[model samples]
Target: MEKKVTLPKHKFHIQAGDTVVVIGGNSKGLRGVVKEVIVEKDRARVEGVAMITKHMKPTASNPQGSLVKTEGSVHISNLMVIDPATGEPTRTGRKVNEKGKLQRFSKKTGNFIPDAYRKQ
Candidate 1:
């Protein structure tokens, strides 16, 4: 018998497509767009960071195996979302707008972050 694996829903301040800066690890000081949010693993795949090489087996697409480069996930704790308003790193906070809609804001500048996923 095989055990079933389940992924828990994780609410992360940083979402996909948000620009973030690495605060720790070898990728520290580097910035990139958030490609994906790995909620189950508590990590995020940032563009141009934590690159790794993978060897692939020969397939119909290619006659020979090839080495492919891809981005690996960085722990969520090591990332800081960049505030578009200030063009700098900032901590995120949640607030209810005048319309009673939940909004994400930058703690440093006290500015609301425009989120596409959330309808206003």
Candidate 2:
């Protein structure tokens, strides 16, 4: 017999399409747009960073296998979102705006950061 429990999903500071800079690992100092975030693994795929070689097996479309170079996921902990106001990497915070909707903000500048998927 075992007891099962469920935990709430973690709220990550970084999101897709945000401009981020790699602070750690071999890709340190590299900057790119975040392509996707893996909530389960707590990793993110950044454009043009963490290049990896993948060997794809031959498929019906092609007879020969192919070696594909693609971007690999980097841990979210290694990424810092760039501030839209100051154009520099900075820590982020979440707070309710005047509209009563929660949003992210840059700690360095105290400026509100707009959501990447949302348009005003």
Candidate 3:
């Protein structure tokens, strides 16, 4: 019988829809919302960050070969949650309220980050 090995967990507490800022790499200082979280791999793809160009070969979907630019995944360690109050990058922590609803807050500003993006 083959045994299944569990993947290591990620330290990042971020989830899909959370706004984040790139802290390292060429895309440093760029801010975008989390589009996908690859928890198993400890990476997250942020919208409008770390874009890379891919040369697509001619296919039935598109007979014309072209270059397509798309977002690339970055390690979770390179991202920091955006603080709603300060509008700056900050770490996030999870807490449970009296109502028992799990909420994420900014460690820097101590502000509750809404699940949805706050209107700018």
TM per candidate: 0.87, 0.91, 0.81
- In model 1, which runs have C-alpha deviations exceeding 4 angstroms? 1-8, 116-120
Worst window of 10 by summed lDDT in candidate 1: 111-120
Listed per model in order, the count of residue pairs whose N, CA or C atoms clash below 3 Å is 0, 0, 0
Worst 10 residues of 3 by lDDT: 111-120
Error of 2 at 12 (Å): 0.9
- Count of clashing pairs, candidate 3: 0
Candidates ranked by TM-score, best first?
2, 1, 3
Give the root-mean-square deviation of each candidate in angstroms: 3.4, 1.8, 3.4
Q: Cα deviation of 120 in candidate 3 (Å)?
A: 18
Ranking by lDDT: 2, 1, 3
Q: What would the per-residue lDDT of candidate 1 be over residues 1-120, giving only the tens digit for each residue?
A: 999987667778899888999999998999999998988788999999999999999999897989999999999999999999888999999999877988889999998888745564
Candidate 3 matches the true fold with a TM-score of: 0.81
Say which candidate scores most in TM-score: 2
1-120 in candidate 3: lDDT tens per residue? 999998666546777888888889999999999999997788999999999999999999899989999999999889888887888888788888656887788888777777764452
lDDT of 1: 0.90
Q: What lDDT does each candidate get?
A: 0.90, 0.95, 0.84
